[model samples]
Target chain A: MGRWKNGILITYLVAIVFPFIFLFLLSMSSGWRFPDLLPEYFGFKNWGKVAGTESGIAQSFLISLVISLSVAVSSTLCGFVISRYVSYHPKKRLLTLLTYFPYILAPVVFGACLSYYFLKMGIFGTTFGVVLAQFIIAFPYALIFFSSFWNEKIKSYEDLVATLGGGSLTTFRKVLLPMARGLLMVCFFQTFLISWFEYGLTSIIGVGKVQTLTIKVFLFIKESNFYYGAMSCCMLIIPPVVMIYINKKYVFNKLI
Target chain B: MFLEVHDIEKSYNKEAIVSELNINLEKHKTLSILGRSGCGKTTMLKMIAGLTPIDQGVIKLDGVRVDEIEASKRNIVYLYQEDLLFPHLSVFENIAFGLRIKKIKDHIVDDRVIEMIENLELQGHGSKMPHQISGGQRQRVAFGRAIITNPALLLLDEPFGSLDAGTRKNMQTLFLRLAKTFNITSLFVTHDLKEAILMGDEIAYMDKGKLKIYKDRSSFINDPETGVLAETEFWKQLKTEQF
Candidate 1:
């Protein structure tokens, strides 16, 4: 029984790790057709192309980073502050229910519905437009994510700070922020992931002009360029991978 | 009176929670307000702390009106049933939080915090986070944090309610000693009958949003509405049955 369990564990590990290894190898190889055991050549040539302007991978990576950072920081901050009011509001239940309205429809449908306003505002096909669309989805997620953070105990802490001769800003900086550091980092990581790999909303709002890394990956896939697709996929996973590591090390461990 | 509250009122949804609340407390004294749960004890304390706005009242501290002041500016500190320590801060930093926010000199903060740590009997634990300490220690840290600020008033909402019986007894004793040493004026709210009698320089009883201040400990014990008479009978019956 123990041997079978160990075998299952090993299989699970390999299953999860296989895609990452395959993507790395596929990104570095080219011309491996049917009946061929390996690619015609395997080198850093494809990786080398990422730095040059011809591939546009670096540009896509930078754009994705900027969009994700903006979305993450803005959503996390707005969510943290607004969630406090929502938690304390007289109409808290109704307000919270409204936050879920964004998630009620599919992102593509939501994006399509929003495209009209985006076009009217002359922001369609712009990076800012894509960011705004993604934020619409990510913001609610952050709001819901931080809803559980404000409880009776947290309120007591705020009151205690007030009584201790610290104003609202002091309470947030000294007590609330430090108490919520782990949750804030976790929220940032989650929202960053939401914005990083966002596609449908980005596609509709970006209008094929604002090529984020996720869009580039889909573009490569559509053209049937497996090598570039694999490379873009590799690039797309980098931030999330780094974030997962950070969330684990700094956020989760501190939380525990 | 160091603190005076007159005809304070609070309501939720047109229903009264605390009504006609009035209190007068002298300097360097403690007023223990005893009540059962949901008897407006917390509401009254929060109102005094400026945490909850009073629908109708005037509050004066040291001959000046404080009802219009913000909680932080009012120089009042409120302690909850739970310690509510800043989990990310160490014991020293937690105790020194108010002083630091007030922008006291670093050396003064360090000296005062160290002295407070000693007074709290928390020696050698300054570097420890709140989670690293026991419940009684956390409660002590909470008290120290509040007292270190030298507030005009301290409101304690059952500060030791979560402790074990032994720890609770010890805390009660420590609080009495600290009250004298720091010259602290406070409102100590609790549901426990004996704790109310022990902790207060003056005693008041609350029922259904109304408060009646007792003349003395004997008067408080004699009041049936305070539940002391019933509690005494129960103890007497238990003693008789055990004997």
Candidate 2:
């Protein structure tokens, strides 16, 4: 039984790890193209060019970080408030479900809708527009994660607190917030990852000027700059990796 | 009068859970609601605690109409079967929850909580989490949390039902002593007839959704049809054997 379990674990690891390893190798190879089994040469030039000091990597990286962080924070906060309202009020169930409808809509369709509104609002060619678009895509993730967390034990605690003469807001701040700290962090990080990796909406809404790393990478691939494109792909993986690491180190154990 | 329940009715899905229930409790008295399962004893206690809505009745504490008041504003505390102490909070913090909610000053809250901990014999356990304590200790903590606010009504929904037999009996005695010392009005719900007899100043027998309140202990044990005395063999044995 143990051997079989170990075998299954190894298989699962290989399934996830092999692709990234292949992608990393492809990104580093200097002279590889189609019809070759492997790359002709492997070097650090591509990585240095894309991620080094002068490649505009630092600027694009900063923009992506700022946009993703803002979207994550705003969406998670909004989701927390909305979920709490729906959970407590009970009459707002229909409205809460309606708020989540945009998340279920296809990304392309929602992107189209956002573009139309952004044009009307004169935010079409701006970073704020991209952030707004990403926020919408990430909102439901935050809502689902935090709502489930809130629903699990917060309701009962709230009732207990209320009976103890703790008003709603005070109970929320002292009891609910402390109990749910770990889950809130998970929601924030989850929202950040979703916003950061969101290519379809970001690409569509960003159009030509407001470029994320994913967009830049896609554009490079289109132009057959596979070397830079692969490097960008590797760069795109950095945020999620760091996020997962931080989550494992800090947030995972604290969650109920 | 410390607490009064006037003609409260509650129903779910068109089925009445409790209908036309009335209770009047004096300060420092312990009233126990005894019933079979699904007899709405818990529901009645919850209504008194403002944890559940009363469909057609009024609850007043010290002559204030509290039927429509929010649970936090109503000065009635409820303790659940599972203790329901905040798992993340230390015992002191859990007991202080109500005080903090009332926006009491920091020193006062500390003083009150410390006093409760000492009175409840929870001196060394103040910093421990709920999960760190035994079942009996947890109930004591829950009681401390509820009573720290000095609520006019303290409702216990089988508060000691989860403990072992010996622990439950010990807690019952401890709780009765605390209730007397603090002059706290209490309504305790239980399925155990002995527990009801042991703890109650007045016994309320509930069946199906109706409540029958007994004004005296002898009346509850001696009445022919509804009496616990008539239903118990030990009472019969004692009646014949002791005489």
* Winning model by TM-score: 1
TM-score for all models, in order of appearance: 0.95, 0.86
Instruction: Evaluate chain B of model 1: give its TM-score.
Output: 0.98
Write candidate 2's Cα lDDT for A121-226 as tens digits. 9888679999998888788767766666656356667778888877777777887777777878888988898888778888778887777787777787898877
DockQ of each: 0.85, 0.65
Chain A of candidate 2 scores what in TM-score?
Answer: 0.84
* Tens-digit lDDT track of model 1 for A24-131: 999999998989999998998999999899889999999999999999999999999899999999899999999999998999999999999999999999989988
lDDT of 2: 0.82
Give the distance in Å from residue B219's predicted Cα in candidate 2 to where it truly belongs. 1.0
Best candidate according to lDDT: 1
So what's the TM-score on candidate 2?
Answer: 0.86
At residue A138, candidate 2 shows an lDDT of 83
Tens-place lDDT digits, model 2, residues B1-243: 778788889999999999989888887888888888899987887787778888898888889899899888888887888777877789998888778778899999999899889988888998898888898888898898888888888888888888999999999888888898888888888988789999988888888889888878888877653547656876788899988
